[model samples]
Target: MEIPLSHFEEYIDEPLLKRGLSYFKNGFVHEPEEIRPGDYEAVVEGSEDYTVKLSIRNRVITEHSCDCPYDMGAVCEHVAAVIFYLEQEELGLTQNTKKGSIKKAKASSSKPSKRKTLAQQVDDLLGKATHDELILFVRELAAKDSLFRDLLLASFAQYNPNESKTLYTKQVKTLIKVARGKYGFLDSSGAEYVSNELSSMLGLANHYIRKGNHKSAFFICTAIMDELISALEYADDMDGHLTDTIYDAFDTLATIAQEDPPEEVRKLIFKYCLTSFSKRSFSGWDWHLNFLHLAAYMLSTDSEMEELFKRIAAIPKSSEYEVKKAQEIQYDVLLKRKGESVAQRYLEQNIDNPSFRARAIQDALDQKDYEKATALANEGIEQDSGYPGLVASWYDWLLKIAESQNDTERIILYARYLLLKSHNPKRDYYQILKEIVPPEEWTNLVEAIVQEAMERKPYYRTDLVASIFIREEWWSRLLDLVKKEYTLDQLAKYEKLLAQHFPSELADLYAERIIRYVENHVGRSHYRTACKYIRKMIKLGAREKADEVISQLRQTHYRKKALMEELDNV
Candidate 1:
């Protein structure tokens, strides 16, 4: 989380809060700097110096991280110390005697030698200990700490190695068992811990892959994939950590397939992928078909190719995305098993598949076959008329063909259509229109575009017209748009552009919308938002207007104590 900076201490554990406060008072946060606005970095003195980075936005700590091995809770003491250091003035922190004890002790010591880092201390201790003593200590520690025991076996897999898939499956199950609560459900934090632990196992698998031990890596990857699929039933993976862990395992398997492992290992992977897909182990997920992709790469025999083709053809066309992925996988199989001619034939037959259609169009264009490309694009446009995105893409292809042929009329046609209808943010159809349209007819054409855009619903039309006005330097029209229809959010979004050219008018609009916003909404969040716009008004050289807005809120919403408290901050 995001924690409000004003009362961050309340959200942290009491013990952690005290420790962080002590660290802050002892001046342990060194070289604190605002590296960028709302971003801070500092070296927080802990067991050793740890770098802490914080991203704050709108007076809330949106994200924070520290290079300290503190994962017992969300916010570490080092991160808290840095936050306290940054907000010392706003928080009104003062160093009492007890709080300053650590600093005073350092000040009083005559020979204050620097302390050893954790690594150096560990090395020194290990050097002093005998081999038997080290063994005994480790054995006892491993016996007591399940986490340490699992980590020990995983990290030193080369020693006392059990290169079996069950070895890793047992380790993962133990981790999940330990993380489960009384009801056998993992909470959010527990789920994160399990994900991190499993990820380390996957990392070891990767290491095995690098060491040319494909069998061991395959075992680890498959075990994690199979076990985590079941564990997700009771685990609260709200943060998607567990899901990502499964994806990582899938990706690792893909990497291993690319390595072209030994025949036995490849056969094992092929069987596992086929079994997983048939069992629908990853049903309702894209991985359900992604496993098929891996299986396709592993195909070696004519019978195997036929089996994979049957599996791909059996996949339900439940969604557009899944249908496209399935069709693409089938195309890959055909291309690999048969010749380009056969795959091209398949693509032509399934031209409604956007990916295949796009590929066919590209192939046609690559051969300078504009006629074929034009026919294919027109067919796609007619077939995929329901999908605006696909239609726009087809039009984009047509625009390219026209540009290649120097057909200015078709360019203007396609470009103007895309500008009005296409929601793809990446394409700059507006600029394309400006460049293609002749200078003499530009004004009338732009007016027509504006009228078409205005005919859309207000929610969609306002931003489009406003953007056009901004680009065309129609500041007055933009201001009128905001005044007539823009919400408070929309006003703030476009304020920076209009602030310089129409500061007074924009500020008045903000004042009006702010009042209307408060009249309709309640709660401290709404109050905070209202006050935020008031501050924005002040930033626009309208301090007096901001004050009047505040005055109106106080008189109207005086009974809302939360609102009054928020107003005080403003």
Candidate 2:
């Protein structure tokens, strides 16, 4: 939510706003520091003190983030409290209001003593208790609380003789089940909770790995991967929290593979990888083939290599990415078992794979085989014409080769072409042309580039031409481009950039667009948005123009009560 600092209460939930206001008046919001212009950081004292950071631009809260455990809504009370504290004057709130509210809240409370967090209270109690008392307390809680008992058992499982993967697996499954909602689905919050809990388990695995207890770590990692992989089916996972947990599990496993563990541990992981891959356990995911990548890292015997090759061959060519991965894996296998010469041959045989082509191109470049590199890159450009990003990369390689050979003609040709058309442009190709082209012809070249950009579809090349105008300090031309469109979005985007040079012109354009916007759109939300621009017009030194826009809107939209009400806010 882009919070407009002018009337933030209208944008946030009323209940949330009230809570935030209470928090602000109670002095929970610490003094916010302007870390830099338009950027603020404040610590709001709460259950656990949370840090809130806000980005204010043009008197609007453009972005905000809080490091608190409140994910159910976009704006947490901590963030709101910080916003209120920052915008007190704009909100017509004064220090006396905060003082009076604090006094009122304190007078109404039965107990006004300062609050301590639950962890603080627990620590206070723990510090007073004896060792024997702590032991007795744990025994009593574990005896009555099944959840506590499982946690206790799992936390200390390293000391128990019967500690096994099953124990941790059951613990993780319980977490998933408990986090599920009435619909048997894990919402975003539920998924986040599960991810954090499983991440804790992975942390334990990481501790064991660092301590060289590979077996214990292996049990924990595999247990998580085994259970949570399936739980993802019913999870909303909108934030990819659940998916990240799975990646963390594999990362732990990768650590074990990297460490030269005991044969028992190595073989255990090797077998798990092969079995999981064969069962298509992680199918429909790119990580589906990651099992093969992991097994390749630990290949030990001829039998293992043959079996891995067979599995790689069995992967269906379902997508271009999958096919590329499979061929790359095959090349890696050949490189490992056969040699670079054999791998090079295999790479050439499967040059359709972009990864293989890139490797081959790099290898050619490394050996100073410019002709071979050029041929390979051009072939890739032709083959991957549909993939503009890939073609851009190939052009980048050609540019590199041209630079290597000091081929001026090809450099300008490729650089100019890339500046005009490469979808995945690497850097300032125009700058490269500027430096390389003779100064006498630079202006002409720029004009040619601008004309090329302007000839494309109106919407397609606006950004391209605008980039040229900005780079060349063609502010008038850039303003003209915005005038060609005169859209609210483009006006807002370029207003700040153009305001200093052409304030009156930009203001008039804004007034015109704001009227068109209101004429075409209805409702108070749109009215608020339109008024937001009216404020921009005022800021651009167009007070008269802004007033005219407002008067026209009021006269034209007098019948819309909501519009009239929102305009009054402006």
Per-residue lDDT of model 2, residues 1-570, tens digit only: 688776788787888788888788778887676555566678988898888877677777766767676767888888888777776655555432444642222211111214553456677899999999999999999999987788778666778888888888878877887677435777666787789988888888999888989998999998888887898888777679988888889988999999998898988888888899888889877567888888888888879888888887777776667667877877888888889998889888888888888888888899999999999999999999998899999999999999889999999999998998865578889888988999999989889888888886633677788888888889999999999985799878877778889999998898899999999998878989998999888887788888888899889889999988887887
**Top TM-score model:** 1
Error of 1 at 61 (Å): 14
Across residues 1-570, which tens digit of lDDT does each residue of candidate 1 receive? Answer: 788877898778888888888888877877455555566668977888887777677778876766576768888888877777766656656543444453222221011114553456678899999999999999999999987888667555545555677767777777787777445777565677789998888888899899998998898888888888999998768789889999999999999999989999998988898889888889888788888888988978889888777777767777567667878988888887897999999998888888988898899899999999999999989999888788889999999999888999999998888888876644798898888788999999989989988887643566678889989999888888888874898888788788889999988998998999989998989989998998999889999989998999889988999988998998
Locate the minimum summed-lDDT window of 10 residues in model 1.
104-113
Provide TM-scores for the models: 0.73, 0.72
Candidates in order have lDDT scores of 0.81, 0.82
Candidate 2 Cα RMSD (Å)? 9.5
Q: Which stretches of candidate 2 lie over 4 Å from their true place?
A: 1-162, 181-183, 187-196, 239-241, 284-286, 366-368, 457-459, 522-525, 559-562
